[model samples]
Target: MANKDVEIVKSSGKRVKFSFDKLRGSLKRAGADEKTINHILDIVRDELYQGISTKEIYNRAYALLKGKETFLASRYSLKKAIYNLGPTGFPFEKFIGAILKYSGYKVEIGKILNGLCVSHEVDVLAEKHSEFILVECKFHSEEGRNCNVKVPLYINSRYIDVKQKWNGINSNKPLTEGWVVTNTRFTVDAVKYGNCAGLHLLSWDYPKGNALKDRIDRVGLYPVTVSTLLSSEEKQFLLDRNIVLCRQLIEESFMLDHLGVSENRKQKIIHEINKLCNL
Candidate 1:
């Protein structure tokens, strides 16, 4: 347990206690064995400073976990790995598409749709049953960034234009919904606007326990970029070939061969993927 008096600083500039139980619980949830958890706890406890940043603590723990179990460390790196998709936002879009597909939704990405006023390029169009969702994927490379209100306001307007165009067709179409999904959190104003406008907002954590992270976890569709065992160059190799999920490796073991990894490393990657995907 953490000392009640020792305060740790968060990336958001908030001060909190260095809770060992919380850390242990998180590692446990990530599939760390008790032995590994105890080892990590002991190391972290000894290194705990008066005002250590949570990021530093997480880095320290991840390093240790990587040494103990590469796959579990990859699972622990999930949050940061999501942030690694950036600049072009292509990988993030593909990841979101994969999640929607896994959830039984037919998905289309980067489509230029004709709206009432003009042509708008939608990031993702997911259809399931009678519902159609036009998603605007707002990805941020930095942590603590937020999807602000203006984004939804703009997306809602574009959605209205597109829906009006559909009405002009005089044909039956699925009910269209607008969403602004991000890899980070949403601002208070953004939530307020989404509530007022009836827009769907998906962020890292919002709406209690049913956020994007929760949705992804529920489906067991984790991205390959989260694997600590894979080098950045190796990860890019998989990504370049449109391999997004680590689970994909199970089907195409030969893909690992292309990366020139050793047989032992390949077996470890396979083991991690199996454990993570619960297969």
Candidate 2:
């Protein structure tokens, strides 16, 4: 148990008392059984120290989980795996497109369109039934970041411009939904403005039960980056080949052979992904 007096620093540099429940909840979310969860908590508790960054705590817990169950560790490290998609938002945008496509949305990414006043480039355009959705994705490489009101404000204006032109062109009126998606959280004002302006805001944990994390968990549309068995170079290789989803990797297991991975290692990779994808 962390001492009530023990304060940990967040990635944002805010200091707060470390809560056992918070840590336990994260572990449980990774599908760890009660006994394993308790064991991880006990080990993490003993390693706790004042002013310890939450990142350190997470690392400790993840290491413990990995040592016990590799699959559990991969699931536990899902968020971190997302961060690894960066240095650029293109991969993140592709990731969002995959999620939407998997969820039955017809997705088009990085399209150029004419707005009412000017031509604009849309990050992702999703069409489902009578609705056409425009999504702008913000991917942050670092943790503890928040998308502020300015983001939605900017995205809203662009969507409004595009919506005017789009609605004018079609005889059959379609519902237009403008969305701002991020890998981080949103500021209170950002959420407020998004709701007020009728823009859908999505982040890792926002929108209560329908946030990105919820969608990923519900659909099991995890990125290939989430595989623990793949090394950094191997993961990058997969991503470079546009094999973003673990499901994609499963179908294209030939890529493993193309990379000249050993038969023994190939079997392990296949096993890890099959188990991770619940196959």
Candidate 3:
């Protein structure tokens, strides 16, 4: 048992004492059963050391799970997979569009809509029923990055501008809500301002049970980047072909064949993706 809190370094170079509760919570959230959780915890507890990085801890736990339960590892890597979608923010935008599209929203990505003051290229535009939502995706490659109040403040202005432009066109569906989604968490002040401005803010773990993580879990919409069987280049190749979601990958499984993937390897990959699709 880990009797004392272990100090660990984060990817952003911040140092903090690790909490077993946090690790346990993550495992539980990833759908690990109680027995598997305890087994992994026991093993990780034995290897605890001062100055171990969070990434190292995560890899240790992930490796343990991957050896036993493959899908659990993919689900556990949810946060990291979202991080892998970025560095350009375009794939992340496509990801958000896919999520919204699956949720019954008509989604358009990278649409250049003219605003009242100036033309703006919106990341995502979703129309469902009488509600049209403008979503701005904020993606960061580093861990522990926080989107601040300035982000919502800026996005709100952009949303209002676009809403005004559409309002003048006599469209049936009106822009109802503006959302700011990030792969990381938003600052307290950012959430505060968002709530005040009626902007729906989404993050990896924000909004309690209705976060981006929850939605992904609910919809079983794992990104192709979450595939453990596929290499980084393969994932990127799929992403470049706009096969961002696992559902899209299933539809475009021929892409794997085009990449010279063997039949047996393809079956393993399809099986892995099917497991995630059922998540």
Candidate 4:
């Protein structure tokens, strides 16, 4: 007889039927080869229980991928890797600035701009030609936390104040736009409010085809947290020193020397970085 359907428990404790298609699709998006994906699916299928936690499944699949291809495994852990950006959101803000920079925009992190009624500290300021955008970066270390309506509400309030000031003084310049960027999903209310308020909202998987994850993958700007080869202390070392992106290591080769690992392991780490970054 065929094996009974397996129930997988999410981090929220909600249980649902296991989906091979979903698993395969995510693996593919992470750049896993077909052979490796099949092998992992087979392993998870055998180990399946009546009610297996999704975390367990992810860990198992990641472990298998790490052994086969460390870089692919890193890509698989992109979401968690983002959380490793900081004990605070400062590093994440810098990382986003870097991403925008890669896309040919001039980016500034931590700018103080004058608003209509008050001065505000902007998380990021990006400019391309005459277009200027003020961004608020919201970082969360935990999974499943959504950016809520209040976040956009507050950001829009600040943006309007600043835009009003800019318009009154610099009418010839391009109008300023506002965005609230998060590393997770957004609440339904948040999406509705952002739409109604005419503010741009960028999240992990929001706005259909054009989300933060999609943009990051489009430019191969994977962060250091994705690397399974790097231990927690090693990853922390890089993060503490402001080495957030995988491409940064490529740009500054000396950073690897600080890791103090064997040359062989270091080479493997470099190889993984190249594979993930498509270098």
Candidate 3 lDDT, tens digit per residue, 1-279?
A: 353667899987998988888999999877789999999999988888999999999999999889977878999999999999878989999999999988899999999998999999999989898778899999998887799999999999999998899888847777888999999989999999999999999999889999999999887999888888999999999899889999888888899998999999999999988887783
Q: What's the alpha carbon RMSD for model 3?
A: 1.5
Supply the global lDDT for candidate 2: 0.89
What TM-score against the true fold does each predicted structure earn?
A: 0.90, 0.97, 0.95, 0.93
* Order of candidate numbers by lDDT, starting with the best: 3, 2, 4, 1
What is the alpha-carbon lDDT for the whole of candidate 4?
Answer: 0.86
Candidate lDDT (C-alpha), each: 0.83, 0.89, 0.90, 0.86
**Superposition error at 278 for model 2 (Å):** 1.4
| lDDT measured at residue 100 in model 3 versus the true structure, 0 to 100 | 90
Predicted candidate 2 versus true structure: per-residue lDDT over 1-279, tens digit per residue: 438789999999999999999988888888899999999888877888999999999888988888887878888888999999987888899999999998889999999978999988999999888688999999999998889999999999999999999888964856379999999999999999999999999999989999998888777778888888888888889888888888899899999998889999989888877777787
Local accuracy of candidate 4 as per-residue lDDT tens digits, 101-218: 8888898889998998999999999988878899999898777677888999999999999999977887766556888999988999999999999889999998878898888888
Query: Candidate 3 local accuracy as lDDT?
Result: 0.90
Candidate 1 Cα errors over 4 Å, as ranges: 12-22, 33-39
Winning model by TM-score: 2
